[model samples]
Target: MLDKAELGKRIKKVRESKHLTLKNIEAAAGISATHISEIERGKTSPTLGALMKISKALGKDPAHFIEEVELNDVSLVTLEDRIVEKLGSAGTMENLTTSIPGGKLQARFIRLSPGKTLDEHPHTHYGNEAALVLSGKILFTVDGEKYETSQGDAVYYNGLEEHSYENISKKDDATMLWVSTERGVS
Candidate 1:
């Protein structure tokens, strides 16, 4: 179940991402700015019709704001619970943590076959990232500097810098545990 306040926050986040102001939503949704503000503050709940109107105004589905999320004070995720995604042809990424409400941290395990690379184009995001090489070797590049790390080694860097990685081993697959924080709200 999703809490009303959480739902309101989701709405606010989506609206902000679209650069929509309360007045803009008011004009598009035919809802007053004051009422929208109240709904966003969780001071009052909007009816399904009003929610649909607001969703349409924001170019989103109403379900986006009302999707059910299971909440648990404690979450246990085993290897079997990991969600794996194939990257390109020779890499796999496994999400290691279940979604946590209001959580900012993410953990993943990445694997690259020998002679392959998780070649991310140089990009930056608002957060910090750390990776621990669990097996084989990696050529970790950050902001034009290259650092090689083997099993049992770790590297940490500000994610705002452009970065990428490559599996440098000739016969061994590279495996690493990657963790990062989510971007902070401005």
Candidate 2:
């Protein structure tokens, strides 16, 4: 069974954290102020679609509303615990090794295969991030500034820069560790 009251509290907390008012959320979600109030006060439950709208209004993932993390019971993760999902050759992605999302933070071990190049995507966020190359070499262009990194080298930036990386060596794959926050403009 769903805990409507708890969910309401979570919703209100997220909204307040983002410094949003009901009027602003209503404008973005097309939901009524009264309805939003009822949901926040635990007087009513929103349908999945309504919840989605509220999450979108807060610039959060819809899944956040239903996520009830019991961190106390979360055990330290081993290699076997990592949930790996291939984003395919489209975008290089690896499983987040941590058992928890680190809340607003994201940590991952990503690999860029040889001869692979990624498209430029701009980032906007509350803070910045750094990337450390573990093995091989990669050419990076951040905010149009070209850079290169070899094993044991690291790159730090605002991450708000439009950036991309390409494996420069055809013989060796590039391995990197990425740490960034999830609260960012995509």
Candidate 3:
């Protein structure tokens, strides 16, 4: 069971959060607006290929959109459980959602430890990014502009700027949730 209902909810939320209309998704995913409507309504199920194409058009991961939620503990994301197996590894991310389930936004949950810095790959995804620091502290570098983040703080920046995160704290762990979406990124 793909949990089309839950997926539909996430899809709807993403669409609304991005301020995108059915026609926008239809244009991006090549899935018909009517079909997308049905999917959002949980009236129809999408095929894997259709789902993948839709995700690509919307700038998200097909896998993240289809995650099964635990009825026992709604806050317990199974994705997080998977990441716990390799807890201490820097750059380990427990994907919170397919980030931008459909449209122009994407989100991820990352855990970083002291002295570990993530990669500096240059990426030009089509959006801006907001990273919410949930715990500990991190040193963030966006196209050479450096900023430090701590619990209760968030960093927002342009997606066009190359960026990476580093755990500069020696005594604590860093947890961050990243949400990104935009009109365009150059």
Candidate 4:
């Protein structure tokens, strides 16, 4: 069952914790800012599709907002408990951060299949992102500039840029440790 007010509060808390404005979510999720505002205020509920988009825009799973969890001073997510999501033909993403209140940093282990990209096109969101190549080769395109990276190489940039990456090797997969900070409007 869905609790609309609780859902709204969770969404609002996560959004604010990530330093995101309604407009930021709108740009990433393709939902209207007004509608997001209403949802955050508990004046309305988001549809399943809307929720999925909103969750993705927040770099989270929809369950992250809906699941009821207690907050603690120290949070730990064991390897066994970590959540993993498939990126279709691209490969997989394993979230490495604990789901604690006021969390602002997101860490993920991304595996990119050979010659595959995480997204079809370059995308932008607020905040800053950094990645360290752990295996194989990656070709990163940031704001139209191309950067070829190998194992041990690191890349850092503002998330607002049009950024995307692809596994450059046709015979091997590429892996990276990616960390990103949530953004807020001034």
Candidate 5:
């Protein structure tokens, strides 16, 4: 059965994940905030037209709200289809996890070029972060403190601390599997 409340919840989750409010949806969808509130609260069901408008406002497809999804034990991402992005002079990063609706964790494979840092400066965010060195050596700095790590070494820390890593190897790239809890849509 298609539950109106569950549909509303899904819509609300996506909107919140995107850091949007009812008023934001209102302006983008051309629907009243009060009406959207009613829809989100499951006090009423939105018409297909209104749902379409809301989905568009949230940058989601209408089916995302209404489709029935079977609970799956695993999600897969193939090598060929992996999302890859260059980090400028820092090297490259490859997404290791498939994007799933309401997923909480994200993993990535980071290849840090020799003498390059993961970011130009230290960064901080909410949640937890951990990494396992796959190759070469890295200098991991957190909150002004430094730790030297080599292949097979693992590190975990609170993401609230300012942290960054650099490939200490002068002639080779350093690789690591980085994992963190997702704060929201990035």
Candidate 6:
């Protein structure tokens, strides 16, 4: 579940980093300055609509504000502690790393059953993505080019392009580690 207070803090941090004042956001997002201030102070939570408007005004994705990452010298994610979510109907994705405050990268471990596919048609995002096949085989398609990768193989590409993946093995499940970094952000 998402934490509202943490989300508010993250929004405040991003707003400050962008040098955006409450009044500026109010003018751009059509939200009241007092309401924005209350949200920043963690006294109130914004609705999805308000969050979208605030994100647009701040020139960021709404996820940038809602993602909760702990700041620590060393963070550990065990298999048992990983958060898993269904990916379409043929695969599952485990978030390998928690979002880091002010950080630009995210990582995930994806598993697909044999003959299953994960397709992202005409996808575009402001970042770069890299994947390493950990087991079995995978067919990765990027910008109309297809590359077959087996265990120990890896692929890297600009994320602002169409891409998709498939578990190409007949009987084995495929696993891969995916890492992506935000574009225009260090």
Candidate of highest lDDT: 4
> Higher lDDT: candidate 1 or 5?
5
The lDDT for every candidate, in the order shown, is 0.85, 0.75, 0.73, 0.88, 0.86, 0.84
TM for every model, in the order presented, reads 0.62, 0.56, 0.50, 0.61, 0.62, 0.59
Root-mean-square deviation (CA) per prediction: 10.8, 9.4, 10.2, 12.3, 11.2, 9.1
20: Cα error in model 2, Å: 33
Tens-digit lDDT track of model 4 for 44-85: 999999999998898777866666663443567788987889
Model 3 RMSD vs true structure: 10.2
**Residue 110: error of model 4 in Å?**
0.6
| lDDT (10s digit) by residue, model 3, range 127-155 | 78899999988888888888988899999
Q: Estimate candidate 3's alpha-carbon lDDT, on a 0 to 1 scale.
A: 0.73
The candidates, ranked best first by TM-score, are 5, 1, 4, 6, 2, 3
The global Cα lDDT (0 to 1) of model 6 is 0.84
**What digit string (tens of lDDT, one per residue) describes model 1 on residues 56-149?**
9987767667768634434578987778899986689998876554456788899998878686576778899899999999998899999999
Tell me which residue pairs clash in candidate 4.
19-183, 19-184
How high is the lDDT of residue 51 in model 3? Answer: 82
How many clashes would you count in candidate 6?
0
Q: Is candidate 2 or candidate 6 better by TM-score?
A: 6
- Candidate 3 accuracy as TM-score: 0.50
**lDDT at 112, model 6:** 94
Q: Which should have the higher TM-score, number 2 or number 5?
A: 5
* Pick by TM-score: 2 or 3, better one: 2
Per-model tally of clashing residue pairs: 0, 0, 5, 2, 0, 0
Whole-model lDDT for model 4 versus the true structure?
Answer: 0.88
Candidate 5, pairs of clashing residues: none
Q: How much is 163 displaced in model 6, in angstroms?
A: 0.6
Q: After superposition, how far is residue 121 of candidate 3 from its true place, in Å?
A: 5.2
Candidate 5 lDDT score at position 171: 92
- What's the CA error at residue 11 for candidate 2, in Å? 18
